[model samples]
Target: MKNKTGRYSAYIRPFSYFIDLAIINLFAILLLSENVYSIYFVVFSSLSWVIIALNVEFYEVYRYTKIIAIGNKILKQFALFTIICFAYFGIFSNHSNARETLIYTLLTLLVVAFAKIFIYYFLRKYRRLSGLNYRKVVLLGSAKQVKQLASFFNDNPDYGYHLIKIFSTDIDKKLAIEMCCEFTEKEEIDEVYCSLFDLSNLQVNELVNFAEDNNKIIKFLPDNKNYFARNLKVDYYGYIPILSLHKTILHDPLTKLFKRAFDIFFALITIIFLLSWLTPLLAILIKLESKGPVFFKQGRPGIDEKEFFCYKFRSMRINATTEKEASKNDPRVTKIGKFIRKTSLDEMPQFLNVLIGDMSVVGPRPHLWSQNKVYGNKIKKYMVRHFVKPGITGLAQVRGYRGEIETDVDMVNRIKYDVYYIKNWSIILDLKIIFLTVFNIFKGEEKAY
Candidate 1:
């Protein structure tokens, strides 16, 4: 594909990297007060930059790329590079000053981050002022979606896509393909977006072949009814592409690592400090109040709909209508059960579940096995919540969607928040939910039983 940000503007990212690297090395030399420039430092810096380039694709910053996202990617690259540098210095260097090296890393990171933000804003302003850096794109097909996409391009100048041609599939497919090919060949068409719902298999293959022959970028936006499906993920098994219905942010290795680390750390603290002493006390209290086991174990849908024994302090009386959910002022809940439930102290045992890897510290709360079956059938995307491990508390619970499911709307809205949490999962968001959960415990939730 032709350069979307104009040919000359393409060098900006590479040039910025080169300048940033020189500045970092200069700072290192000044800070270290080294007699000779260490070859180890030079070689490591070069190789680390290469690794960062491969990992981040730093030059692939498109017009639609958010400034915050760009800054984040730069920060990630810097973090990785800093880790390698620290390891190198820690393991090998006798004279390495940890404090100085730390200061150098922070300074370089700040410089890079500031440079990236400044450059991004500069480019955006330049594009808006000059009306340049726009890619000439062609749309094939007259589907309603095609028009909607064109509207988006027209509306968002920052997207940098300018539709120069629209070929309606209402006309002959062969002629449309030929015209598209000719235009791509004659003009600087950066991309061809095909939404040809009416095109046959052979015709679609022909269009793809023509784009390949001309070395033009072609993207297929399937006009299938499920195109607007929630949390759609495309996975490639060798050559075949499989469309997954739902996937969560935890699917990312980094996210999984961070969440798992947090889960383990938090669970360990709770289990060791609180549960170690509180368990016996709670067990005694529960035993005195109820005739059943101290802990309530139930089969609930966990990650991937795998049944796992979810553990909680047994709040209700033994065999108290297992099929029926406890409600406010329910007799099934013992006198002590009501207090523990209201304060969310009954859920303390789930920390063990978190430590054991059956649950996360923060995620969609698990539903009862039978409730999962019933709601999974009634609600459209109910089971999608199980894509991630069930949590002690979740976005839904923090947003007052917890407690008994009273209506179909209640379940649907709960699932909606679950999906939202899955899609937009972040460490900050998880912490916010945890904070809110704690806050709710203090302020009290009306739905808490």
Candidate 2:
């Protein structure tokens, strides 16, 4: 099996989806242009499918390649797409060309469903039979453990572990030589899975050097399976391999979706009901004491490092944006600014940012673009915080890592909490943070500033 064949087979899943969406989209315009919004409609729907599908491990090529399984996948994708499709349709249901009945839309959905299944399976079979796919892989651990693994491999041939040979990292060179001899002189193997735990701290560096010095691929079979799965991201493009500790949204998609939806809904409620009254009151107070705008808008980075304007009540004296960050007992803060800073009323307008998807009701708070520039240069992996949308309030804030950062220790700890939130993100965790925030808001603290 050649690298090209293996690469094509690995890519078939995503390719099938691209073709399927392309076909359904083409059919929508050709067949139902009168009622359906076909052009931008297809664009949004397809993009969502691609991102969400990839997130959900839909493209991961495991051993299962049955037609029944493929059919199930098509059905699942259609069901999810239907949810997106209906949401879009409902938003514009009042449009002149909207579908008359949900039933008609569902029928067309079924047609697209079958079309996708056909394309997916056709590609799978073609790749399985014709694609010269050779997966570069190594079995980890020693002869005993690998023999156990080999037994497992014998059971699951479709796994495609191209076992090259066994490599051992025994503390005693005599043991290593004997074991390597047994495996080489006796059994068939492709590559080795090394156990660093077998080596002393001093020898660990040498073993790593030896493995790196060789061109052979190395697989580390750590004792902790869950830890390995959680930490390792191994991506291979043909013979090229890359590893990283990256996150996929599928690990917690429902939570992420719920968080965003709640942000929008709560933000909408704030603007529609509370803002009308509060804004006027705040506006009068702000205008009486300050020459600046009633609402201050500043650019901040959001999810995936996209920039968005964040809104807040005018808390400080005019032209205070560039001079310094807001601080406790700062003379630059106006009477209204001082009160709002303590009470956190200044942050209310950011709810609008939540509604518009620029921020969340609860996430790591976005820093000033200037602050981001300052800290990002100083801190390692600081920008990973922007992997999700910034928020109105966050665990760091509620946990008292808020207000002025007087030291590097504070900023580092703040980032630590932020990354912790991102990695362990869940609806339950978010709900806890929201509850804590409301508790802090009413209980009130000087640090709220």
Best by TM-score: 2
**Local accuracy of candidate 1 as per-residue lDDT tens digits, 1-449:** 12233433546756886887787787678766473238778778776766675567654466666666677788778888788778878777877677867887888788777777787788767766777876788888765647776776777665556789888777686787778778876886868877646566677677655654344556655655454454444432222233323435687545675788899999999999999999999899989876889998887778756677889898898774776778879988998899899999999999999998999999999888778657754665575686689999999999989999899888888988998998899889999999999999999989999
**Which stretch of 10 consecutive residues in model 2 shows the poorest summed lDDT?**
1-10
Instruction: Give the TM-score of each candidate.
Output: 0.52, 0.55
Residues 277-372 of candidate 2 have per-residue lDDT tens digits of 999999999999878789888777776555678899988876635436777777778887888888788999988778767888888998866767
Model 1 residue 151 CA deviation in Å? 40
lDDT of 1: 0.76
Instruction: State the weakest 10-residue window (summed lDDT) of model 1.
Output: 236-245
Which candidate ranks first by lDDT, i.e. highest?
1
